[model samples]
Target: MTSPTGEPARTRGPEGPDAPANPLTRLPLDELRRRTSMKWRTYPPDVLPLWVAEMDVPVPPPVARAITDALALGDTGYPAGTVYAEALDAFARERWDWDGVVAERTAIVPDVMLGIVEVLKLVTDPGATVVVNSPVYPPFYAFVEHMDRKVAEAPLDPYGRIDFAALEITFQEAAAGGRRAAYLLCSPHNPTGTVHSRAELAAVAQLADEYGIRVVADEIHAPLVLRGARFVPYLSVPGAESGFSLMSASKAWNLAGLKAALAVAGPGAAADLARMPEEVSHGPSHLGVIAHTAGLREGGAWLDALLAGLDENRTLLADLLADELPQVRHIAPQATYLAWLDCRDLGLGDDPAARFLDRGRVALNSGTAFGTGGAGHVRINLATSPEVIKEAVRRMAASLG
Candidate 1:
């Protein structure tokens, strides 16, 4: 393999790792899965919990080095050094295809969704009405309501697809109700894994434009799309300048515990954020910034490999559901590692989460938590080793049987 300069490609494996010998492929499925997941409670060191969105993969080398180097200085107050925001620019230029999207327009937020909350606060007034499409990331409503704002639910259509017409209508009504600044959306939507296409995004932008409302696109999961799937940035889409794009390496690289993210906005939006509190971005977690930038700038190789692992686990999940619990239709995810399963067949009353825990000995995110459209669904994270994921499915199968 030759490099762009015609030299031999760097010996680093696809994801640029050293490509260690006999890499840890898949651990013992059932035991390891239980051991990790059962941590919610003091388990007997058994029972892997595939419930959380965290992946079991190791961090890329550069990220680890960056964190370690930052800590070596023993200065973690507020990142007043040089390397703090270095990764943001490089990452934006490369991975986001931004060419030169000005890191100055990007602000490192404490958490991905916090950026959303801040946007909602800045754009909407107290008691303002905001529109949200259901089966959304449940926290979305909480953010709106916490701000003393009103929430309007426009559930997604059957099969968990967005309804552009419905969104447009809701936008109009919300605008009329005086909460014109509405939440644009959750991408690769939380439970469904449906990757909103360029067309869908356009429709959303168009609706936002129609009502003179701002769009807050929560693009936290943009990097986790299925192989070959296209992710059009909210700002990249036509008329997307009316909105802002929220990005974080936390979800893709399992860095959520670090609590770091950024909001990349357009010229108008950037100017709005500029006048805000001086502490709004206060350092953005120097360690997290390093890891994030490394992931975006150099983690592509690692991401490619990780995505391959996730893709395999995704298939394992689908086939296992079919071969085992026919009623548990595991809808294939187009992006993100979360698997949305139609578990209506089990037919338990409201909140089947407890039922799965007690009987199936498996933990899952009950669909009802998401929205009106999540009545009989469950979201599972399959970002662990294949062995663990398979066993988790087996346990569910046995319980169902």
Candidate 2:
């Protein structure tokens, strides 16, 4: 059987350097539907899901081999040792040219978001304010509030970047009540995919120091930066010694289901991380550490190939939008595979995702959940086949008629 795009659905074998330029799109839609990931199972069979952050690609061969070898030897006990942390340190130095990440100062956690929540608890008190950039990942709102904390949003600038002036105002407000606050910064931000420059990060570090607001950066998308953009580790900035950053290979290698992440503390913030309870360390899966480590240490070639494919896909998306949905404005992301489309001109109401799902049978993340400027927008996942992306836009355009 064929998918909505008229492409035949086929399951893929393992991926290697020899795989297609975009190995992600090689999997057939019918085979993809058989998987149990949220990206596949969250919607009805007819709905083309392009919402969640999960990539449709198979794991790199090295990552896959690491996991399989462990399972063969029944090595699925509790995680042990500093291999994961060491691998990350090596990857960071090689990939981003940042040597600030000390393996001794890092700890493994179940995932990046959980690490953020745990780190926030260390920096802020109950009911204290937590600052975030609006039009951000939805979980930033949910997780912070789950801690009984108040969330303050500093909306992004029109160019989809951190609004330094607005951020300073928010930081000042967050610190006004003599309450300790935390800034949840999304580097290479979600939805918009704007990679922050060094100057921008420096400004943030200055503001955080001025207001005494603890900075917890979610750098999960660090490795997925496309061509022409750079991913800088927040800790690499001069005055960011007190910042805490959460890193993971999950997003880069499509290993979210395995669940392992690292929380790195800047030189000044090591004590804060040391205060994190011992029990939290037990959440990371044993196999997850192995898988993620393999991806970091041995999967570099696979990652390079994926980036090239994603680069092509991004360019293709710009062309498709221009030809098929000219009314929709997209910035053609510089980092992540997510494309933030401004659909306000289409006159869709506050919740365009709902209309798209109901009318077009394409599932996209609702922009309303992103807060503030999010209304009349939708976040589309660009990690799938070019054909699927073209088909999704075609369906969306047909829905408008």
Candidate 3:
């Protein structure tokens, strides 16, 4: 199949070999605007929305079929068994070559954020401190505060990598007075798209162990690691045996609305994970489990195609910024579809996203909300067609005039 621009499309449905080439190109702008999702409904029809992490791609054929089959059978009820965990285990084993996700040691939760909250409860108290690397997903602050936990920032280095010295200082401060602490690690980090290396994860595990801090990794973006990068499961790290990890196909498969995730426990952390309330398992919907399971179990080919498209979009965006918005610094991401843009040199003040939305009619995520070091930046969702990316850049450049 070919796209509107006559380029070979890179998408495919469950329609065997006849599927299209690009998932991002499957849905056109008019069709997208008709949907009522947050990405589409958040802005007026004239504004091009690219703020949220939601991708502008069609549902994977296997995922759609699974949901359809379940609905046809009237299989809407509470989720049961360990099918989701088992599927994740298989995917991880094949993709990351790690088998730390033992079904017996995993629990199903509503989503990655909820799963994280539950895991944090198991290893931390209401008032305990949770350390985070700044300029991260904003929810890390909102959710942690909502759970009545204090937050300590361990800002990432200037290059967007983990700063060991800053982390150690934050750990010391958080663990002072013999207080229990937890480090919320964002593997294959959001916005920046910096995939943590195995050695880097090992270093993190080492720090957590020395500070007597428990680690809970949010590996939701693991499957979206584009190219030239690797995602290491936290539990697979040696010193992380006492740590926890929350993962889901939600981000990769655009299943956020389906709402199903797993909280995996390392060998040494099994007992603490076991203490989670039984009611927590009741949070996931039966249909969600079915869809996520199908995606993880049978959506491998679809995921690879999506990754290929995203890789292209990242490179396209870098080239666009260089030619049109040269003042905007874009560090091409190593993973995921989100692009972190440094607009500090654009002379648009802290929240350049506002200018882009107001003048350019393009909505991007304001970095200010992403916490410290987020000012003078905006996050652009690159999970769309190349045309949209090009247009967004054009609009951004026009906004400056």
Candidate 4:
């Protein structure tokens, strides 16, 4: 796993000069000129902002062209977006081989968060217990409370992995006298970046079926799986063919601001989708429908390249960590551009992230923000340039030197 510079850069995977790769990782030379000349009056110039999980790459060429083409027609209002809807259905079908009643099952929402809130309300009762794996996405907690339901925190075990043993006990305990109504399932779980295997999903489906619980799988991270891993859609699992799956191009393709997502329902999934708030979606932005369709349908090449770049960046971050700071344990992320670090040994006493940031001048997504299990960890996003990642690690080494 060592690079020519004696750093841990090359991770094990398919190797070759023509190895599948993304061309966007390389920052243009003109960036040097701009960096040399530019100055931001609002924030400090020295800040390496990797905390927000935004990619620095330009919008994929095809997506940009599609937007431009749409604008040329002066078609920008909420007049029947029939063509766009059709394109999205075809795109979803082709991309994931997910077949369903496209028009009936699918509806455009401004964001995935909105779709989730709607679904949570539909599945749970007032003061109902919604099971969640902590050290999870912040919004999972927010969405539960936002819908007037109580969140039952199921803390994942050490190494920041899911504790299925505890999960079973928790579910059983919740439904001791009656049925456990719902479970917020994060397939290709966020924060921890654990993409559940088919076997795991089957077990989950069995338990949910046993308890008569509704599972809402947030599958936004499915498309971002790295080289050696495969992302399995929860609803598509053999046992979960009757569950709900929430999907978006935002996580992988940087389409969040576009405001679009597809809420795929199972055979009996209509009740959940139908119960969603009516006013929440006037329908997604005109451009969101267009860009999402173009990206999903015509974006195969762009996606492949983007994944390659993410893989390379993942390697670079691991190497830097191995050489620059050995006490911080880490695992080769099965998927996603995120690198999870075990900073438990840092022994910073108070807030480890705060100390690391103060000393290294590197802003990381605080571990505590991900819930209890993330106490001594930080999620490092490698979805940016190698130079930027290296610099952040360099700063970390110096700060803790």
lDDT of candidate 3 at residue 50, scale 0 to 100:
93
The sequence of per-residue lDDT tens digits that candidate 1 reaches over residues 326-366 is 87765587788888887877776666665766767777887
lDDT of 3 at 72: 94
Candidates 2 and 3, the one with greater lDDT: 3
Instruction: Quote the positional error of residue 25 for candidate 2 in Å.
Output: 2.8
Error of 2 at 253 (Å): 0.4
Q: Per-residue lDDT of 1-401 in model 4, one digit per residue for the tens? A: 43221322323243467553554465652452244212212225566656665666667777898889989987677524445446656754654465653567655667777777677677767777788888788888887787778777778776555678877877876566684467788767777677677667777888887777778888778777766666656776666755777777777777766778777777677766776776655767877878877887677667777877887887887788889888888777766667778888878653566766788877777888777777888888777778878888898778876
Ten-residue region with minimum lDDT total, candidate 1: 3-12
User: Which candidate model has the greater TM-score, 3 or 4?
Assistant: 3
TM-score of 4: 0.87
Highest TM-score scorer:
3
Best by lDDT: 3
Query: Where is model 2 more than 4 Å wrong at Cα?
Result: 1-20
Candidate 2: tens digits of C-alpha lDDT, residues 1-401: 53222323222222675654566667888888999989888899999999998887877889989999999999999988889989988998888878877887898899999999999999999999999999999999999999989999999999898888999999999999678999999987998988887778988999899999999999999998877667778889878999999999998899999989999999999999999998888999999999999999998878877787788789988888898889999888878889999999988888888888999999999999998899999999988887888899899988988
Order the numbered candidates by lDDT, best leading.
3, 2, 4, 1
| Poorest 10 consecutive residues by lDDT, candidate 4 | 33-42
TM-score of each: 0.87, 0.94, 0.95, 0.87
* Cα lDDT, model 1, residue 66: 68
What are the per-residue Cα lDDT tens digits for candidate 3 across 1-401? 54222323334223457544779989999988988999999899999999998999999999999999999999999999999999998999988889999998999999999999999988888899999998899999999999999999999988788999999999999999988899999987877888777678899999999989999999899898765666778888779899989999999999989989999999999999889999999998889999999999998888887888898898899889999999888678877889999999989999999999999999999999989989999999999999999999999999999
For model 1 the local lDDT of residue 299 reads 70
